[model samples]
Target: MTSEVTIRSIQAADTYPLRHAVLWPQESIDYVKLNQDEQGHHYGAFCNGKLVSVISLFIDGNVARFRKFATRPDCQGQGIGSQLLRRVLEEAREKGAQRIWCDARAVNENFYRAFGLEPEGNRFYRGTIPYVRMAKSL
Candidate 1:
């Protein structure tokens, strides 16, 4: 079923809770906080007035990198994350980003591929989980 979701720019701190809950529940909350968060554009998807998904965009020169993208387990498969990502990509392009990329978890490679991001370089592991660098031109 589809839900009424709103995607909006939010402060970096606002993403911590959701990011920790969905992306790194087994690790300390601090583990989900990125050092470069303050230099990025943060967006959250609110469904039924509750924050259900979030993504962060960091731009350096013409390249925009998004990290810490996550959706609450119960909210996964509802398209909230996809909507937030599309909005972020559009905003990045509007801001003159020539390329957008992320180190996507191996399992999520197909998801990013759906949005035109292709795997680049060899796969690496963050802890024991595998990841691949993915990118696409804006």
Candidate 2:
């Protein structure tokens, strides 16, 4: 947190550790991995050269979806997540995505809203966690 955050494309496997650590500490690290990870574009936010946040973006036609976005718990309020998300959004647009979306944790809906993503559809559950679809036109 002492250094500036840098965002860069990373291999999908590079996102696994932080994804497991921040999003589901109780689950196995494999639980945080997506079957289609190799086909997606992954981005990491590094602070002082230490990876602190990760997000995976997938593009299909003109639609882009981002998943497994997790910021290190200790780095949560430092604006690192914001920087990473903004980069992902710009990446999507650069890649010809007309829209972008995510299955956002219901409790963190406000965070997505700040980036112009609006909640859509009803709330749903993944195990015991509540989630909602959020999207925005790029």
TM-score of each: 0.97, 0.97
Error of 2 at 125 (Å): 0.5
- Residue 119 error, candidate 1, Å: 0.2
Clash count for each candidate, listed in order shown: 0, 0
Q: Which tens-of-lDDT digit does each residue in 1-138 have in candidate 2?
A: 568899999999999999998899999998998999989999999998999999999999999999999999889998999999999999999999999999999999999999999999999999999999999999
Q: Which candidate number would show the highest lDDT if scored against the true structure? A: 2
Which segments of candidate 1 are over 4 A away from where they belong? Answer: none
Please estimate how well model 2 matches the true structure, expressed as its whole-model Cα lDDT. 0.96
* Candidate 2: residue 106 Cα off by (Å): 0.6
41-94 per-residue lDDT for model 1 (tens digits): 999999989999999999998999999999999999878889999999999999
